[model samples]
Target: MSFDIPDDRQYLESHEWALETDGVVRVGITDFAQDELGDVVFVELPGEGDHLKQEDDLGVIESIKAVSDLYAPVSGEVTAVNEALFDAPELVNEDPFGEGWMLEIDADDTAELEALLTAEAYEDQIA
Candidate 1:
């Protein structure tokens, strides 16, 4: 099996992906994660301005097969939430990296991203 692991972002062993740009980090689940979960039915996410610690519970993603907890890959204040998911959760299955992005956070420490896995390493992990 193969998965889409973009080199532009960092990944957690738990399957969250984080892409940082100008101090803000966008987060979402990986394609492999969505695939394993089956079709996403709903997503529960933190509101804007919510503060989160690294590894904190970010939210829940419900799929036909299972419910999964999403974790914060970096500590920070949530800057935005993808409201679109509430209406069309299937976006997670169609575009895990783009329109399916869960949230964006103003990271407390951008350097923290360095601790995450690279695309190559993440690919190896799911392999």
Candidate 2:
């Protein structure tokens, strides 16, 4: 269950991560999640500009194995969604942290990111 998490990002117990850039936080499912879920078949994403609370169910990702909810890592208003996922959901299983990113939000509070798990902590759980 061990996985490598990028030092530059913060992770959630739900197997999501937040990558902050210029006040906006990019969100995506972890590699472990995609691997467990098998091939991604579809994605249901929140619309741009939609306000969300921390831990809110922002979307659903359908995979060959099962459907999993995608939550907001922190409270914010969604600024963008990866529209490409609509046409090519497999990218989630192929390159989860790269082209598989789900959405970006203008973060409401930077401190919210602190509540997430560190890479070591995340690995411990899945291990």
Candidate 3:
């Protein structure tokens, strides 16, 4: 199946994606990732106000296939976590980039977003 790699976002080799808007960085697993993981069963996310560094483990995503780490794409304080996922983790598979977003961070440096891989680069990696 083809995956959606949005041009507006940045991605990591490990399959996390980040989108920067209004100085906030929103993070989630890529479509390729959720597909590979099978059905999501649980999510462990950081609380709001938690601090993180670039590449730090921000949370865990558990699936029938495996349990994977969710990393921070940029250093910052977490402004929000998708608390809804705690109740309905299947959303991670259903709408990963939208209502399924894992967290929003107030980025420490906007330039970090530029250092990330483009959607094409990410697609190449997964391909």
lDDT, residue 71, candidate 3: 89
TM-scores for every candidate against the unseen true structure: 0.98, 0.96, 0.98
Please identify model 2 stretches exceeding 4 Å from their true place. none
Question: Candidate 3 at residue 103, lDDT?
Answer: 94
Displacement of the residue 51 alpha carbon in candidate 3, Å: 0.5
lDDT against the true structure, each candidate: 0.96, 0.91, 0.92
Model 1 TM: 0.98
Error at 62, model 1, angstroms: 0.5
Worst ten in a row by lDDT for model 3: 108-117
What is the RMSD, in Å, between candidate 2 and the native fold over all Cα?
Answer: 1.0
User: For residues 1-127, what per-residue lDDT tens digits would candidate 2 score against the true structure?
Assistant: 4565777898989999899998899999998999899999999999999999999999999988899998899899999999999999999888888999999999999789999988778777788
* Model 3 CA deviation exceeding 4 Å by range: none
TM-score for candidate 2, please give it. 0.96
lDDT of 1 at 55: 91
Instruction: State the displacement of the C-alpha of residue 49, model 3, in Å, after optimal TM-score superposition.
Output: 0.7
lDDT of 1: 0.96
